[model samples]
Target: MHTTTEESVRGCPDCGSEIRVHSRFSAWCAACDWNVDPAPPEERPGRLARAQRAQARRHGEKLLTELTAGGTLRPRRDASSVLAYALALAVHAVTLAVAGAGIGFLIRGWGGFGMVPGTLLLALAWSLRPRLTRLPTDVPVLRRADAPELFTLVDQVAVVVGTRGVDAIAVDSSINASVATYGIGGRRLLTLGLPLWEILTPQQRIALLGHELGHYSNGDTRHGQVVATAYRSLVTWEYFFHPYSDVTLLTMTVNVFYALPRWILLGLLLLLDRLTLRGAQRSEYLADRMAARAGSTEAAAELFDWLLVSESAEVTLMREANGSALRGRGGSGRDDERIDGLWERLAADLRSVPEHERERQRRASIRRGHSVDSTHPPTWLRQTALRIGPPVPPAVVSETGRELRIGAELAGVRKTVARRILHDGYGN
Candidate 1:
């Protein structure tokens, strides 16, 4: 997949040491980390941002310690959890109160100029109403009839994780996967990112599915419509009270009048964020355990290792697409042929990475406290937690023939995604 040559070797400017270049990655000195992250970190964040980061890191570390120390793995209904739910209910109550007031106004001002305020209040109430998550229409959605093998595999994993199987599977070009609920009935949807799927071993694929489905079994309240919609309502309130930008006396006076309410809303939003943060993080860890239970600890741990290289994998795909576009200028047929092999080349490139490089990336992740997001714990911690206990045998296995059938089912999606990248570029 990758071959070393004189052209691929260079001296690191910072350390003046030889650095071997990877075909899919930037050359950097592993010893000194020269150009490891070429772009500078963003400018110092605001005080609130700094505080939030600090709080998240503290929670992550605390949880890691508790897990590694033989503490309970399941989430407990602690005070924070109770308070978070109470606050969410309070948010819903406020919206209901606003709606009631709007209806009263509409009734009282039915035949007068007062109808304007009534209408405005009703509009505000409607805007704040709880919303259902909807299925994304842009991606390819495959049903049981279309991809029976894949759906069956997901069903097996769901059984292991103690959750209902997905209603449909969606394929996209991202290097990530997720499970979410949609519609008023809250039907489950599984989104599989083809880039990530192509590089993983079949068992690792099961691990990916296990991890996503585990959220459903883990009781992650953050995903519940009640809390989610409440958060959205707070965001809407903040937007409505946000200071105006127009440079005029009237605008300045209006901003001054709204400043107090804006600050109050901001406080509420931050409070809700903090209250939910711990439970969300715990859910992620519990989900990881479920992943281990479903696909085996080894497979789950390997999945995390793959995640560390996801950015590199994405960059390699983009580079390949760009190369295809450049070659297409000479002729169309050759570029089309190369585009067909994009996934194969990507899998080969990632699989061929040196162990030393993988270790370096893992260490770097620990140093930087890398995570998927603030709602999750550090990748290194998650990986470490998986290894702390005895290895688990997979409850569900991926058979070779079944895997091939699933691959055949996804062939059309793969081609469509490849062509889109070739034209629209990666991360479009």
Candidate 2:
């Protein structure tokens, strides 16, 4: 939270007090009843759950087609994905046209029935509009020259996965490896998490790369991007369309009539959203399977478990290290040479969990099923999916040995990544 202390734009005009900026979208005066945020948040004029929603949705069936069913590993078109794409497109079209037509009509016939549909349509369109943009703050981009060993490893994984090559590679502070594609032309980008790279064996690293690249190869990336954007719009629409209005005689009547169509729009949008999530879930499973095939299912599965452990261990270590620095016990260069293997530390921390607790978590992982909003299948399900079919022979991407030859450089890279993560935290 940022608090203003001067008579600036952010300070309170009436009271001359500092305004408390609770968040980017809201602020308030502490001395009076001046709420910078609306009671109903007029930002209908505005604005974001996922525990593992990304993981749940990231896997699709195409990448792991051979492993999931009896066939050679290859990408297959998903009917649901097509439907999701179509629906997302249809949603944007209808919302925009409705907004234009409705607003034009309402403006011509203000304070009448036209106002009802017009306001609603405009709101819907506003809701459907994309409200979020990813801003890169801390994650650093890596050129081929910056990390030739890493880029070479990626090339090997790409060959093994048989995917179109990515245009750029970024080293992020996250513990998960991910890929992003932009524009209709599908300019591709890959993000490799320093945390994941810090501990994963060469085979596991290949698996990660293969899974991310598989999204591009399967053509799911393009469609998935549409659905993902549409899903966020759904959230925005809901906010704008919340059932609140002025309670006057005329407005009460308008509100009464507005109820039916609003609910109808809500129902329609929600149903379409289900299809989007379902397709994404399939994609996640497929991506997971692809990674497994590229490396080994065992390594892929272990990676997931390690991810769960890593998230916790990483936070703990960062906190402890920060606290230590605050107390003048250590910082920056103090442990620069000593903090590379976050995954190894994470593994050691996992061992501290009681055996029974570990057993319980394993059971829980298996019991977890497909999540409607998650991108990846449950860890247990991913493991099970790989085992049911004859596993693809692991691609002998012996590049790991070659990659490891640059271990000193890699270690320095890891230390830099860790420091940035700890110092800056993951920027939004």
Highest-scoring model, TM-score: 1
List the candidates' TM-scores in order: 0.89, 0.66
lDDT of 2: 0.59
| lDDT for each residue of candidate 2 in 1-428, tens digit (9 for 90 to 100) | 11222222467777877754422223445465354323331111211124234334344333345455665434555675677778777767766787788779788886587888887777767767744334244567666667677667677777776776666677776667778865566567788877667667777777787788777666563345666677676556555556656678877776776678667666655556455555555565667767877887777766666654453455655754565356552655655533554445544554454433343344444433423224455565566666775566667454646876656545655666666644444332
Q: What is the lDDT of residue 99 in candidate 1?
A: 82
Quick one: best lDDT, which candidate?
Answer: 1
- Report lDDT (Cα) of residue 306, candidate 1: 89
Model 1 agreement with the true structure over 388-421: per-residue lDDT tens digits: 8789998988899999999899988888888888
Q: Candidate 2 — worst ten consecutive residues by lDDT sum?
A: 40-49
lDDT of 1 at 19: 86
Task: Tell me the spans in candidate 2 whose CA falls farther than 4 Å from its real position.
Answer: 1-74, 98-135, 221-223, 243-262, 308-311, 325-358, 368-373, 398-401, 405-413, 424-428
lDDT of every model, 2 decimals: 0.83, 0.59
Worst 10 residues of 1 by lDDT: 39-48
